[model samples]
Target: MAAGGPPPVLGVDACRGGWVGVLLALGRPSVALFAPRAAELVARAGAAAAALTVVGIDIPVGLSAGGPRQADLLAARELGARRSSVFRTPSRAALEAPTHAEANARSRAAGGEGVSAQAYALRTKVLEVDAWLRDRTAGPRVVEVHPELSYAVLTGAPARHPKRTWAGSEERRAALRAAGIELAGDLGEAGERAGPDDVLDAAVAAWSAARVATGAARSLPDPPEELEDGVLAAIWA
Candidate 1:
């Protein structure tokens, strides 16, 4: 998997509300969104995983005590992540605890902005899910993506979207329509931008997937190490 060229890139925009996966091949990204079901994500990730190397998922891929806790955080710091982010704090106390899952379920059940933080944390579980994906699957290496820093890579500069939000289905369809791409779903209205925001995020996440897939994305890790708990070598400095 580590031999030929860089591995395919996989990007996951995970949240408590739901999660999205972007798989990019050649130079295009394929998009999928769901409620972050473990079994389903692994299955959905199959296409790009076959030839993957570097993955840029929009989730915090490590634990932290004060700062960014994951490998991506080191990347983010290099990329200039402004202001500290609670980001993907654990929803549960123990890694094996049900608190995180329960929090996720509760957030999903509430709807609205209720699950904002939990959504971020949901990526942790998704990361675990990614691990399971690799163990059973036979292609591509996967890595976590920090959404903000990822945008920096995508645009060649870091930019924050304070008011910007992920676009919903109809919104994405609208943008695709404007761009002359076929809409995958029916959008009941056009004035709504939130829907579009979610879609745009998914697209960006897809871009991350594509970059890692095609060797366009660079990894800071000199001698890349297999990810594990409490390993400083896991991150590039």
Candidate 2:
């Protein structure tokens, strides 16, 4: 930890085998960890509870029962052409589907627009984090974030390339470096455990987490709303 710096913050992103966490303490470079479930990630944060002040994850935090969340709608508008990056989170019923087909059906039944294949693929991850949030007694320590939106906030404009591409990763890395965030060590390790883009996303998420801890972050849907389970439904960047 740096002298007189704030407490640590955690930023996470779902990856190939599970979730990738980037822990940022006292404004220094971050440390990365991998977990197969949100529970494992939460446990890691809990273990160092005194050091951890905020958690920013690249996943939806709260869910709607049968419609689109206002936060999702606001995020889409902010992203413009990249609006597609913000998928409409399906209702809780849709998130429990056993298959993509069933997920879409359940989404429609729940009065949502229906699920996308990309969104459907995230159902398990969603449920994992959702379950943890529902059981959380600490009043919203973990908040939702989107890598694209975070990048946009950092660069002062929308990201120009898709994160899956080399150009995109380089662009985001450059932005982070410019912001004084030294992505030290082999970020490739993060890619190896998760995917090529995972490390950068996790790093940016940590940056956002730090912002949240310092009260410099912003949220979609301003005041935020509550999920059926009472979790706040908002996205931060």
After best superposition, candidate 2 residue 148: deviation in angstroms?
0.6
Kindly provide the TM-score of model 1 when superposed on the true structure, using C-alpha atoms: 0.54
lDDT of 2 by residue, 1-237 (tens): 355555788779999888887777774555777788866875675574445778889988888888899888998999998899999988888888888889888888877787898888898889888888767676337888988899999899989998889899889889888766666666545546877588788878888887888788899988887767676788888
For candidate 1, write residues 32-128 as lDDT tens digits: 4453453455456564356455444454444432222345435646566442432334322223334655554544443412234444445556456
- The lowest-lDDT stretch of 10 consecutive residues in candidate 1 is 186-195
Off by over 4 Å in 1: 1-10, 25-39, 45-55, 60-73, 79-94, 97-137, 163-198, 220-237
CA lDDT, every model vs. true structure: 0.44, 0.80
Best model number under TM-score: 2
Total clashes in model 2, counting residue pairs 3 or more apart in sequence or in different chains: 0
Best by lDDT: 2
Q: Please give each candidate's TM-score.
A: 0.54, 0.91
